[model samples]
Target: MTTRPARRTRRTGPALQAAGIGAAALLALTACSSSGDSPSAPGASSGDSSAKLGGTVTVFAAASLTESFTALGKEFEREHPGTKVTFNFGGSDTLAASITGGAPADVFAAASPTTMDVVTGRNETATAPTTFVRNRLEIATLPGNPGKVASLKDLTAPDLKVVLCDETVPCGSAARKALDASHLKLTPVSYEQDVKSALTKVELKEADAAVVYQTDVKAAGDKVEGVEFPEAAGAVNDYPIALLKDAPNTAAAKAFIALVRSPAGQKVLTAAGFLEPAS
Candidate 1:
């Protein structure tokens, strides 16, 4: 039997060259086929994988976020031309309930961690919620503060008609904490479903004052005036944002959350009277 040429032997012959070229071609074909059949990476850190993003990103956010989030949403759409941002703004507890009850949302931005827990507790979020901003309670009185409400305790005067967010809402919860911190008890004329409604009562002149976030008072402009109190420092709420586990448009939604946490997004929020997130 004839011995085969040594495997490592150099050969300048056309026959050897042809054989080497054929092997390389076979390997190239194998690599191409494997790469084509393999699965894609689960996600990119930028929330924009190699795939193009286009679709509506549905966000369930706190009622207090109406102004700032709306502004940020518009900016998001501008940055991602083909993408759309839709929001369901409401009381944090109500939003959390809707999410747990199977609402199709790509993101959730709660006014408080307790409300956020209502979703993260059930593993509805892709990751732990992140605190994007902090908010403090402020007394929202009619324009010029006709009620003369100067402190959280002032809302307690028997003659004043005050409105408070329902105890379940984040603003209400913070108000409660603030009241506890000050060791005072208050009874509002009515307990509204959300902070905006509570503030609306004051704006519409239905009530003398309402305990709401400073941002809401600022957003109201001439409709209302904000009164800051020392107790507010004790009850500042941390606003949290997260990507939903069942997000319909993951890439776009993730990108939206990223924008909300970005410096530009913080500018819009801070301009609306929201405080920066605690370090």
Candidate 2:
């Protein structure tokens, strides 16, 4: 008598069926999205694989790195076909300034740590920089050494038309440190903005002598004669290189940096009179 017949449940029609189908479709889309990779994420294979790299990487380097980096750039291009490398070489300080001022550069190879600091301080570097090479100063005399320049003290001679890098440049700062370490005060005929400029003056015979980097003198070859001074040891310049934070070609940029720190890169720099970075 308490079992009044159990009521039969009503079955849902097309509306309920449609809602069930919609929910299933939504879940399928979610699963597909979750399984795929995001476009912005870095691919593990892209880093070391040359096939994944194919774009222009612009490098801004110090004048001192001109010869060495140029060689490295060519090698990089050879290793990764379909990649183009464009270089802008100048004073490290100037390059740092340009990069900080919205210049488009994929990589920066500075002549000194202080110059690299300029870019790092501005949050321009993607990662902590690594020192690749070091350099020391030398007096670059005309081909014939007509000034008879031999030491830092010889640069102080009134008869000699000595040129130095402007204090704003890395080479100039290193030159200043060198002169100070020697307790030598020199009044140069002019202060060129970069080591290359100062070296160029002596190469062109515009100045009787110039205080430039040993690398520069070596790169200049027969155009100038290098005179190593004892004080240069105290003013060694540590070159730091980094990939820019906003690099347009990050894959290629990283590869280029790897090449620069490679053994081949070191050989080129060492051949150009640059010292190897301490391990």
Task: TM-score each candidate.
Answer: 0.82, 0.82
Candidate 1 lDDT over 1-279, as tens digits, reads 322221111122444433323343234323433444322213312234455778899999999988777767766665567888999999999999999999899999999999999999999999778898999887878766666767676788999998989989999988888888778989889998889999889878999888898877766666777777777788999999999999998878887887677555665677667899987
Every candidate's CA RMSD: 23.8, 27.4
Give the Cα-based TM-score of candidate 2 against the true structure. 0.82
The CA lDDT of each predicted structure is: 0.78, 0.77
Distance from true location, Cα of 9 in model 1, Å: 91
lDDT comparing candidate 2 with the true structure: 0.77
Residue 169 displacement in candidate 2 (angstroms): 0.8
Report the number of clashing residue pairs per model: 0, 0
TM-score of 1: 0.82
